[model samples]
Target: MREPADVAVVGTGVVGLAVAVELLHRGLDVTVVGPRTGAHQGQGTRAAGAMLSTFSELEPQHDAVRAGMETAERLAAHQAYPAWLERIEAMGGGTVQAPSGTWVLAPAGRRSCLDPIAAAARAAGHSVEEHDASSIPALRAPASSAGALWLPTESRVDSAALMEALSRAVEQQPRATWISQSATAVSAGTVACTEGETVRAREVVLAAGCGIPALLPECGRPLGVPPILAGRGVSARLAAPGVEVEQVVRTPNAEFACGAHLVPRTDGTLYLGGTNRLTLDADPAQAPSLDEVAVLASDAAALLDPRLGAASLLDTRTGLRPYTLDHLPLIGRTGDPSVLVATATYRCGVLLAPRLAQLVADEITAPGSLDAHPYRALRPMPAPRIDDVLADGAAQGLLEHLLQGGGHLPPAQQDEFAAFTALALRALLDEGSQAGAAVRRLWERAPVIEAVPALFALARRLEGVR
Candidate 1:
């Protein structure tokens, strides 16, 4: 038994730490649980490229409400980051090394994809400047490259440094307790850990990311929390001897992932990222595959610069990104008011941390503040329309295939292939659930097909209730 605290924050990833720090700053006694080694294989914080991209991450959403809510959250985080970073630094968290601005480029044939992205950014009041692909300094754009759009507001930080700073800030807080152990269970006001240790608190927040599903059943009461899957993303660091870029450069959002991107870090290294494979097993010890590494390298060379192929691969990292059925974050308190959840931010966890932390803290300090909030935990998650799913799946599937050397196909053949893909996706969705022939045939190739199981489950649950 341990002394009770005001709040017990489970999980030590970026969001967890951010929430703990926010609560502590508000004069609350906090006990932070979860391992601090920063070596968790699925930990998103440390393995992140840490892009503060509000506009660069945008993609067309089928659901208007979901899109509006997500845009609002992203804009709020973008606005809050400067002040939030200042406050963290004031707490001796160390200055974060974040390069300003980002360049979003489209491959030659894909130039049209940049239109909606640029339009969305401009609509959101962020400045978008057009630049000739060849004129972009330090970039060896392929001869067939389309133009580029420079978002002056987008930024990125050194993920490792940011984590160190957050951990240091929490450690130095007098009212904060850092428990370097995994939390096994949580009751209304108590959290149980390995070795039989427990910490009682007035409120318990489950920001465990992919670890949430395991602990949900152990809660003293049913949380009615939605299903969360692990989107395992593999990224690598490279030492490109003479290759240098002053800004973050990335492609627009791809099929089931944030397209390949390069972040120039303060340590004179480049971060190459953009692979996502959703899995049912959220194993923290999962290893990055050689195929993932090779694809990342190949993407960098083909999409950004040919010189990157020779860059020394400093290391590879794997992070499990938590995502819900509709691919939106779950924030705010659950059905059990004393229990709150703030996970499933997916690719935007790093970008949305500050805003999410503040939202969580506000709910704790002032109940009912978030009663009407759109992202309130335990909200009904209806299954997305099957037609929309098939269409999006086919589009993304074709894009993925084309990127992987299918671009060499003749125009007529490409159209035929697209039709085949659409039909294939429709057939897969008809098979029902993730374990069916759908997952077997398209799990690795098509990203959207991964959500079928959860969608079917949600639809069935909703139907039963009706």
Candidate 2:
């Protein structure tokens, strides 16, 4: 292998790009490997609207609250957007007009959800105001929401534009390289890509979403160090039809879990999103059911005039968000000195990128600088029993396709399925007196449901059944 470059980021998604930019700015040679030449131009980040807020009208939690505070503070102190904007204009890239604040709206019935989040936000050192239905519309136009809370510090960015600008900015730096290829595996200090290139880096970061845990062998972490899983989100983008809301609007109780966010861009484009679909593969072009679109449209029309609805839908897309089994980001270095795990930021990837990048870069450059306890590579958690996993697969429809649809199993789910099938095959292969009984038990208990794809996957896992 060639001598190690300063750093090699295995994915050029938002987190990968952000870390590369931070490292390069700190005078490190960096190479970004991904299918795209641009940073953050991959799936989810490219489709996101870059809403930097701690509180959500739909669901508020401590992770986002803390992450949001850090992000807001950093953006304000570093003037991150201004620096990004300058680069955008220089590269003839577009701009996203960020309002001075953001608003979280609640439906009449779901007002109770606000109390916990609001209290948490206040404790986190942010000002939160509770407004009646009347004040909400006046605070920002098209305010038909039942109630609203204004966050003065929250900001939004044009995700695609920022990604493009970041790509250009990094390219302008002589030490930065963007490799257009997918990494096949990792060894010692080098990452092998499908393009017949092996890059040796002083340090390697596994920032590939959904694919993180699978690369554990190369990350120098345990095979299953991170038990994180992936969840899918789909979004739609539309042209802004002159209906301006001074802040990003989030509605709860809409058809989509978080309702829809209407973020008006500086260039008059409005981003309307989105929905959470838990399946493994969420292709962008997958058309959302009419039911989903209606919910988003209804939410947007309530916030703005119906004219905003007059705009045509520009694109529909989906992103696979890396969700930990416990729903927190996995950051910090592993026992392996050369490898780092930075996956499972889930929905907060964009909001938490700046600080996360800092934490990651620090861990890479100075692994001994901090206690790696919370983020250490050790997995104290035990792998759930294959029986329990099989039940979950049944619940998640891992076997339904084999029974009803005849669909193919997803590759990621195949591992868990293999474990399940091993148990069933063991029973069958045992050749004991009760082997027939085991088959009946498996059949009776492993039926697939309509919603869970994992069940169908589990059924297929019984590949060596006697």
Q: lDDT of all predictions, in order shown? A: 0.79, 0.59
Candidate 2 residue-wise lDDT, 1-466, digit = tens:
5556888888766777778777876789988877764333226787676787555533432255445544454444234545545544553444535556776766534466566557656765777888764554422434334566777766777777677766676677778777788888865578888879988887888788776655556433354455555455666778754555556776542221344577776666667874554554434345566755665565556543456567788876566776554455677666666767676676667766766677777777777643543444454544343455344443223332232211335756755665665455445434554444444454343221222333233444555563
Q: What is candidate 1's CA lDDT for residue 379?
A: 73
- The residue pairs found clashing in candidate 1 are none
lDDT of 1 by residue, 1-466 (tens): 5678999999998999999889989999999998888477679887888888787777654355566667778989988888888878888788886668899988767777687668778888879998878867798977788889998888888888888889888988999998888988887898889968888999999999988878867432367787777888899999998679988988877666777899988878999998886676667787889978877887888888889989999888889988877677888888788989988898999889999999999999999878887777867776555466656654545445445521456668767766765565456556665534534343432244455433333344545655
The candidate maximizing lDDT is 1
Candidate 1 achieves a global lDDT of 0.79
**Number of the top TM-score candidate:** 1
Steric collisions counted per model: 0, 14
